[model samples]
Target chain A: MTTADARESTPSSKAPRTERGRKTLRKLLDAAAIEFGEKGFHEASITGITRRAGTALGSFYTYFDSKDEIFRALVDDLSGKVREAARDALQSELPALETERAALAGFLSFAREHKEIYRIIDECEFVDPQSFRHHYETTARRIHERLEEGMNRGELREGLGEAHAWAIMGMNVFLGLRYAVWSEEAAPEEVAELANSILRDGIAPRSSNKG
Target chain B: MTTADARESTPSSKAPRTERGRKTLRKLLDAAAIEFGEKGFHEASITGITRRAGTALGSFYTYFDSKDEIFRALVDDLSGKVREAARDALQSELPALETERAALAGFLSFAREHKEIYRIIDECEFVDPQSFRHHYETTARRIHERLEEGMNRGELREGLGEAHAWAIMGMNVFLGLRYAVWSEEAAPEEVAELANSILRDGIAPRSSNKG
Candidate 1:
């Protein structure tokens, strides 16, 4: 199954049985994102989340066991959404370099719309260390897989590996933090193209031009 | 003055008068690193930091007025040390790419020795947002300066600028997080070389080898 389908089926014990139940679960996760994002984990309360969702307190326990559980679930939910955003941008076949550029552009747009994502994810380091690590690890792994595919297609260098993926992931993430979350001084397309140029030719002077 | 000298002169009101006082101040900052690193800003207490330093309450007051003050001071101290570490690695003049490699290697070694640096710096985002942003902005500015120097020296391609610096900083920081702080699976030199290769040639296959 695709990542979105997997996300839909995850946190299995609390999986919704009815369409109405799924809507409530979605509402809780969305509300948790805002509550936790604005107030952070320590200051964020389940009551606040429920109030934001306009759902009853009973509806909360019906979906999540506690605040921590929902927070963890929210992180997982967001991670999947990040994947989906990138996936949506890669719906058509494109050259490997263009693929990377599209993915970053998509991420920048998503981050701009969901500015709270940075705070929520960063707080996970203290609030939920395992989830924090998992998010980046999984994201890097996905990037590595894409790099491997690019290599197999003879579009990238032969030796690209986990380190290269980590490098690209870091570049995209920091760019989002600067351009998307911090300020939109430059357009996302411009940012993505600049990063893509680095991936294409690096900062080294071309030998042909040196002479 | 150099960054190190500036670091020494900072938070100056409570500056040490003698060698003994300097030792006491160092003790407090080091202890604060451990306290804030392990327990985080909220759970970390002034007494906890003082006890860890093996200093009395009077010494804590001598340097910092409260936990918040010490945390802010600690962030500044650590940011300065990060610069010093990179500066130390770059004591000798080398090519621009080599400079980048040495800086990454230095950072990885520093992170391994002081794993708490990551937690402490990350926490500053919430506890002291200004310091956190300042730390990254200054670091990026330094990198931008290096890139400009590289371009002027004819060692790097032209058009490299602030975005490129942020990209390189992100790459080094994430690589240190994965390889140094999380695990020492890869040697610092090896990781630095891998990143340097990307800076030099990127992940694109060389045209000569395309056949």
Candidate 2:
């Protein structure tokens, strides 16, 4: 098909009910996420996304201005879910070590369940550079806040609260990229354990944070 | 031009034994890096790379196999230079802190100088997932070795050596992605400070560690 033909399929049917609109939008987004995840954003066509969703090309335009816009909406949707999952994961009354594990597990689980969304968000830099940074900074900030709460509760060590939080967040993201995106050999539990061991115990010799 | 045309232009020439070949390859890689960085692997084409490089189509294939191969070679080439630069940065009997800072600075400087490479490696999963992981793990292994050496010399904290090394490497990589790739406002030096703060003082509280 011509590029434009592939770019334009059928349009979404307009509905008066907000719920119907929401459902349509969700379907379109979900399809877009899968397509973007598989093909990369630039390679994905609007026609492909709509066809997958059983919608029209114009319908997608009704929801998003362009492929880039759809990609952004997808990232935002998934990021919100990840944030919520992280929050829920932190709700336990476990000690520092356990808390750390739970948080990592929470993130891993979120990544595992929403594989398409995960891929789309992780590779957002290719689709749109600015949005990637915005989302990354926002997520980092959320993780920092969580760690700050842990610090106040005497859960984390003193010297580098925010710094550690950032490092931990970075570790989690990289590890998730590995376990979720790259390899299927390492089970989620295994990945979580390795991450936890490295984070809580650290790489220092005989240096458990017995404090 | 077609996608194949876009990738073939810049990758054909051999490593410049002569100044002309050298200049041509340099120009081609530079141009390709920008295109690859902005458009990503799949979306970027041989024609685009060549056009930017101001080189011939046949010349592009002479230097590299395919676009995929060119990307792989690009990653390999960049990693070697980065490792060399990091090693050179530590050229001294300076105290632990100075050495660490110098090494970090050197790495950051290299990252700033090669922003396109940074984007390629970081966002490469979209193009070739396997190659990205392979390159990343290889780079991680090298960074680990450096940190291991530092620990042996008492240049860095002992214990959990590999883990700490990984964290440090992750820190540098993520920061580079943020400051150099995703971010427009944050300077590389400033990002380095954020990392430096972590190395000097870890995130866990001193009290917890002591205990």
Cα TM-score of candidate 1: 0.95
Q: How many residue pairs clash in each candidate?
A: 0, 37
Kindly report the TM-score of the first chain in candidate 1: 0.94
**Candidate 2 residue-wise lDDT, A1-211, digit = tens:** 0112212222333321477777888799778878887887668988989999998887777777788777776776666667677767879687765776787778877787676765687677666666676777777776677666767887765544444555677777776766675555566666667667655544443343342
Q: Highest lDDT among the candidates is held by which one?
A: 1
Candidate 1: where is the Cα deviation over 4 Å? Answer: A1-10, A208-211, B1-10, B208-211
lDDT of 1 by residue, A1-211 (tens): 1235334324666688899998998999899999999998999999999999999999999977888889888888888888888888999998788899999999999999999999999999998999899889989999999999999998888899999899999999899999999999999899998898889877888762233
Give model 1's docking category: medium
Reproduced native contacts, each prediction = 0.72, 0.27
Q: Which candidate is the best by TM-score?
A: 1
Error of 2 at A156 (Å): 3.3
Q: Give the TM-score of each candidate.
A: 0.95, 0.75
